[model samples]
Target: MAKLLLVTSLNKSPSLLLLSRTPSAPKLCPRRRCSSRADPEYLCRSIVPTMHYQKSLPRLPVPKLEDSMRRYLNAQKPLLDEEQYKKTELLSRSFEKGIGKELHEELLAQDQRNKHTSYISGPWFDMYLCAREPVVLNFNPYMSFNPDPKPEYNDQLTRATNMIVSAMRFMKTICAGYLEPEVFHLNPAKSDTLAFKRFIRWVPSSLSWYGAYMMNAYPLDMSQYFRLFNSTRLPKPNRDELVTDDKAKHLLVLRNGNFYIFDVLDRDGNIVKAAEIQAHLKYILSDNTPTPEFPIGYLTSEERNTWAVLRQKLLDNGNSEVLKKVDSAVFCLCLDDFPIKDNNHLSHVMLHGSGLNRWYDKSFSIIMANDGTSAINFEHSWGDGVAILRLQNEVYKDSTENPAISPKDMPASVDSSKAVTRLQFQLNNVLKEGITKAKDHFDASVKTLTIDSMEFKLGGKGILKKYKISPDAIAQLSFQVGFLRQYGQTVATYESCSTAAFKHGRTETIRPASVYTKKLSEALVREPSKYSPDELCMMIKECSMYHGKLTKEAAMGQGFDRHLFALRCIAASAGRSLPDFFEDQSYARINHIILSTSTLSSPAIKLGGFAPVVHDGYGVGYQVQDDWIGCNVSAYEVRDVGQFLECVHKSLEDIFTVLEGKPVKG
Candidate 1:
């Protein structure tokens, strides 16, 4: 779901984010360390050197024009009525014979120009960065970690310190080029030849792709060189007001409705142990006020373009110095001690700060609740969720490997003389009024969102295994059935399957609401009594297998949507009259994602996912585990999350019963 943005102003830290686990920390991969070079298995595989990954990786390929057009037409059929389909077909044929030929040739020319990167790179980059919308749930995605088991470890300071150490290690791994290259399944049947692809440019070669995915742990104030500072996204209008100083190594601590900064790196540019970090936090926790009269952070919740303008005005009106101090800090840590333990509530705070409690622009924030629950809220403009998840998986693993140090374990020379620096924002009456307005806007906007997180014990993965079906395919098919049952029609669905099978690959659209999907769901819902359980099961299998086939195609970078998007871009670039196909109602109808879904599988992740993409749609992040299936369903006031979850549950049960040869009830 991540696209690179090519803006000069560096807001996103192009790096891996974070992940989570409970008392027993989870491991991402079973291989503890690199196998012996002398081993037979190690010798069998030709491992490329880390530094040469880019050189070894192949460039993203352009799909055949005819193949893409055929798939595109087939995808549009289900979303359009017969009359609309006829019009779409006529327009599509005209384009295939006329303007499309020229555009394809132009695209080939553009591909030659950007031979190193894919044809979609530049356009994808603009789609993310050029837009002025605030990257919250609409853009930036987030995932909350399971609550810390040890009460002492749950302490905000303790958890934050541990997380930082883990983050440092993760960064070190990236720098050392030891991080494992991601491998996505292209086609399970042809898995031998299409095994793995090195997508991420570990060390970007040039400015064109340089800093495109650089995960800079933002710096604050530094006592030494190479110290990183935390960059803060100040609340303003029209643009993102970034406050960062390269010299800063101090951590920005947000708790009890206030901001504090303290050095996390020692004078020698090494991470201070958890004990010292905790000591600094303990001092701040004492006698801190629970509320702030003016929450300047709330100003960030305003519309992005508006914020850019307002921030510039504020800078001119006299808050530049204070803003600098707040901006130039290292990473931000929020001590959000909320009463609710629900994942939805935690997710809400992490995605969009709990009203003045966070500055959401930093690459990553340590969100620690008073109950010791923690998660990371990050800017999605830079890295994808997997990048961040890799870091988190490391952190979760380390939490167990190196348990929190005792106070006695702290060094005798630990500095206690330097007090935590409280960041003071010099807000005039006008800025203060703007903060009030921002708070109102944030509260009103959030009030309309409904998030429902459910962990169903139906054992979806196990059931799928019993029936020999792909978990992902079944989950998606379940969503399709649920939508049809709830809305009485198949809505346009966007399912993100990895395109990490090629160099610099991101994601491709796996449209879930297909013609076969509709056919199967319609049969299941409307004429349940008309067919035998075996007959219905066979039809469902056909739909799930079709989904699986499309998913594999999407992963291989041969999907229809991106090719169509590239064609549209090409036509626009050529200054040619847009084809009638582009203007067809079918185009818009199929592109509007009513059900934005993705399945992230990890036994360690208890509750993991993102919010809805559109206001009236649902963002369904489901974890299809072995025993049970967990989902975090988010929707706006227009769509009920609870109702959607109920429909999904009913659909899964109905489908599962049919597959199990059980008679349908009622």
Candidate 2:
């Protein structure tokens, strides 16, 4: 019965980027603390302090109505037939000249009223908070860290200790305003050097952004960085809210379906000694408690409203103080008792876990399997990948470079038994039933999902560069051809491009399926023999060039999706009837995204992915490296993920062959 409810919820859900470029890591300060503010070390070992340009960052621009509508029509072209296209085009024109103009004005007025944040920030937050589905697959995503270079450091006890210590250092660095500012260096040799930094540091905070811009570098908005610590998303009846308690000093640990809390920060807000943290973690790892019959953590995987009701019951039953502790902890570190067997197993474990050992509501959780493999599964409402990726890179570099715990290190002599307290919940019969039901539903839902990965070593970014093709563009083209070969049709696809270049920016959609890609895919899949290698290569180049344009536009906040969405939101809020454009079938079809994809390529990350947005769609997380292209894909039972991956491999090979001036293999 619980399974049926989960499936029903799944069915009802609106089963609703880029080349792999690693963002530059902030420079770490020297080990010694400087007494004088004028010291070079006190300047973050760079000219500009972290967040130096945040105050001067430009606001995200709302594109013009006609421009957005034009792009929308172009994106809709390849997906619709003659009649359907005509109707949508007419509806779009009517909306643009009439209600859309009014809505745009209203949106501008609202944007003016909210000068502190982006126009889309409020609506975007509401979108995620108002979601009623469980966050497990619907909202939360995971990115796995690469194994440590030192094998011994991968030990669960040692790794968790080092990560926790490094995390504390990162927090301290940010708090002291000494961390290096996040930047995108277009010409690293010129702009990412000490000389450039020394010159830029003298620029006042109000004008620091222009100084960086003048150097052909862009400073990203780091407003979301504050939410990276001491935060959790609280589930309410119809909407959830994010809450943070920076004063909380303890760390939350989940093991064997049990919850434990211990202070990792001192009363003066200093990081506790590493040895003491190791002792506490070692004690937790060595415990032999059996899994709870009704692991309360599973309740976090239930439907949002359901979880809200169950949480209120807990508060009514003398668990309010304990719940507050769980909510206010700096962050969660989940210790899984089982070892992952492979990459697929790692994806499964990290993305959702066994459903018994995860608290899905925390802002972010560092999960360590028994084998010491670790990843971060984060709640999506409070932030995006920019903050999370920066944190992961810094943590990985620090822990690997300056590990505090070694294999021979002994646990501190302190009595961890007295320091760590296992949270005791007085679960009444109703709460117990809720846990059991949640567990059953979560298990059933996950059972229907599939995760598969593929690595193409045949060629990657280096080889594509030789052909003057964009690596990310070629990757998206492969998906188009692969889907065509599998289903004999083109579908709406989404590629995420960050607008972090602007203050309070989120993301804009890059519609990857365009007329150029359609031509390329059809030619490759249907008439490979009709075109010469040169002709096919030309088509490939066209797709790459056009995709690059789309990427730039989306990154600059010129994409049509968000603008249209904001206008629709304005009309809805004003209680005005939606324009004809909103009611068009093409809008619905284009939004039923079938191929939802993103790329985050970094040396510190091994793999990252999320569940498909729709029941029948595929979630593609890929990284295009210098010598290989790796993809981790997920889907529900309705699709053949394995077969789809096979098609993608073949598509890549055929494209590479054409690039090599050879005919497609039969």
Candidate 3:
């Protein structure tokens, strides 16, 4: 039976039609086809006759269509309203019942933020360092399962995440020192050039802003990052405009209130990506205002030096020192679950004694494949590689499937001795070996976006949507993402490209006059810092010093030279040749995904940032995924618990030493 709903407007006439979920074709009616051309139910339901009238839908004319729609609305209005009323009543009843029950909820009220728990402080987090803008992370839902979350399981995921980011977080002090005393000056419109366009660089307001909204539907297999903001939308429009003496162009908004502006070109280089990225960033600024941007320099411009090459970008600039201020490191630990019944006992044993560690009593995830094997995934935000893996080993060593096996089976002091011995040493030496191996394996297969011709050919045309370009902008970003994943073990995000006058000191700033140069720039640098970049970086910028912070004297060169350097710095940073910080162990390279539209195009770039973990006893630890792009940190550590503890100790020591601007010999 069709459910009834009361709606003042005709919008609710058909409950099925009223639904706003992604539309899927309806299932076929249950009745089978009849050779007699009629079935009793079909006749009673007015199907065959109704079909004739429904067919008229294809022949709609302005007046007739309007009249028919109104008549249809009137016909079903009563039923629709009744259905709406029923649903409202049902919803109200559920609400009242929930309030009346108030059993388990009262306890929850203790932690609730709003009504009863005003004095009870809720989960508070400062994502200012994690992003250019402050972002809030609420742990309530994850922490508030009907049954409490298992400490051990949470520990593991946190540990893995932290391990993956240790090196970058560990060097913040040094990185911050190198980041200050530098700035990128956005050029103002020149006197002779006219005040037609404005330019700016893109920065993200939140990490989720870049991962979720800015690069919302890019090609990268973002099944992972999307989870961070899958259901998130910034609710902010991304658009801006630029005006130069020659013409006005629109821009797009990027992560940090930066604006993006670009021009159409025939090249496969960073130029196109840069232009598009700048435009999109600009658009996000100015509230998606359809303004214009005046052209400046070729987007493919590359300036290798500034501070980014040496890991300065990772520095906090004294912004928020949560990670540096932490006295102890946070660690998460988890063990892989093999279906063997023994493994179940092993999993349980891992939870013993460490009062905080526990198996997720009732948590479960669906297995897309129905094979008998079960996969257990844990989440942790603390612990280094050494501590994490060693913990796993200990769990395995201590487990016994037989319930008959109890404390009686072991010496009275065994449990206490193990815990004490478990952390015998502070940190471990796992990273030394693991990172060496990871580098070799990773570098050999480093596949990222290539700024070459990216084309999508749609067969059997009459493609839906008003997009003129065949594959459209979306297809382009997707193609880039697909290419990156195939060759690289990372995620790609779109950064807004730029559209400003080429820096021509003391001269009337003018957009590039060479279409060929523009094309060459686009074809080669569309996705800079990929395995293959454009020749323009070679042609336009001085590539030698592209490796580190350009000295003040070097950066003080003429306008054209400075622009060349700036552009090169952008490309080199994107390409991973430059470090956002000095002591970074690995490189951080994010693909630039560009969107090309007829009037304006925007490109989105992804930045590597820090992830912090707050744990119960282990404390807090911060990690940076950009270790590969900047630092040479290993993804795993040795499996000795003693050694693992040592690494954490050393890392914390190093973090604080850097914060103090002095080295520690202990």
Candidate 4:
């Protein structure tokens, strides 16, 4: 077998890496540019097993592959080590009692179909953006006066409508999610109750509209997978910088209070943008439909009238009014505006798909078109990209037909979910403290910080020109899969299917979600007590696995409360609603899977070049051929079409390593 060698261009700074495959590094730049080849250095050369330790505790035995295989496949050992039972024995097992036939049926059905599947719903976060919407505005508060469906629009509609019903069926086949549409805009007097339910289906399952309405929030569908919005303008910089070049001016309609600024960075290293400054600017909206009664009550006079005006204003002037209303509206930001020049504040809004918790608030990205003719990689929370593109085509196609279907006549419902279970298991070493104390935990930015000078190895030039992550991530990911291939006939490793959540095979654990949950598991897997920590770790793992698996499939199985598992643990632990606990606990499990070398003591892969920031937030890595990627998507994990080139770089570099797997243990 060949050892798959991989490399990346993302870490292009000196001490980090250069863009070369022949081992010759890129031309070194004297001045450090934050986004340039490598400024902050964290390239350590030594290979240490792990950095985990407690003040003065002895090293606990790391489980062997043999032991792990037994625990994963045969279920040989009880999840909880004996010592765990002795320690937290006083905790109630109320969840066990509540978990009845209903719960069992749900899990069983899900397992039968999506046993080897994993799920992920991306959002607009940092790095690559996962675009999705929480809900659709069936009643475009801002209906355009010129609603003409060009031939292309009709064609898209035709293609999308044809696939929808079948797509729903596909969802069932995988037992990933259900297509349930709830109504929030209907009035008993005249609103079509049945009609509205159908309308909601147009929304991508990523939004979990039912969940959103229940909680009173709206998530942004950044995926634009359907290409629903017209790209009036594409950000183009004469140069290849986000700032120096021009991007589309996204006019938003966030109420002054709906958003909280999470980060504001400038090239010159200053947090120049502020919410207060942003407040001076108007948040624009495409549709300004006024909900006579929304958020569980009638809108105040000011709010109602403001929305009416908002919709009207957008239809009349698009974002022109927004620019007028908000003084901080941008014109042309320059590349010099970052690290050394200016700062841009990325106002972090609650991604309706991830719910109100910040932990699940991942970033979003868009795929660029090679020629700016069509969108290639976009997934919205409200609708799928292909579906949206189809819708666009359908509208155009229908325009040319003898008789055309009206946009209002289309089915509004879409399957927007996957077999995502918030597994009921625990990590190997987490404690209650880790779950409850988020502030004290490691911060992503801090974690991303490098330790020392970035290492620009003066190595062979052939190895320096370009880099790829596909092989690197695959090198690690494939090993995991190959192991499962041997023992995972019944269950697939979490990484098996990257496109959808319902895929199944022999998996080490659930995917998409696993990449992130596992990271969370690591944080929680701690030894806080004098008793044997192993016992607690094992118990937590089992419970988490069972519950997580259950959550992902509730949608596919009828009458299955998605929270069936959460409710169970509530009972098993002799407690109340588990959701209440998550909010109270603040332990978010969403995987912000970023692509980079994991924080293992040193990143000296026996045979490798560089790691790219493939997946963001979750910090997991991924490798792919340039032309292949994205099965399921989120608001924060998308890249413009051009980003795919990196995938090509990755594949070319790691082809050999992929065939070889990893170095055989001594």
The C-alpha RMSD of each candidate to the native structure, in angstroms, is 8.1, 5.9, 34.6, 24.2
TM-score of each: 0.83, 0.93, 0.16, 0.25
lDDT of 1 by residue, 53-156 (tens): 34334456778878787888888877788988888888888888887777788888888987666776666544554456555556655656765555566655
Error (Å) of candidate 1 at residue 11 is 32
lDDT of 2 by residue, 124-187 (tens): 7777788889988887878889999999899899999999988877777777777788777766
Clashing pairs in 2: 15-614, 17-599
Higher-ranked by TM-score: 2 or 4: 2
Top candidate by lDDT: 2
In terms of lDDT, model 3 sits at 0.18
Judged by lDDT against the true structure, how good is candidate 1?
A: 0.60
Q: Pick the candidate with the highest TM-score.
A: 2
Q: Compared with the true structure, what per-residue lDDT tens digits does model 4 show for residues 450-546?
A: 1111111222123212332222232333222222222221111222111111111000112222332232222222222322334433433443454
Q: Evaluate residue 164 in candidate 3 and report its C-alpha lDDT on the 0 to 100 scale.
A: 17
What lDDT does each candidate get?
0.60, 0.80, 0.18, 0.21
lDDT of 3 by residue, 423-501 (tens): 1111123322332332343223212101111112222012212212121112222222222222221122111111101
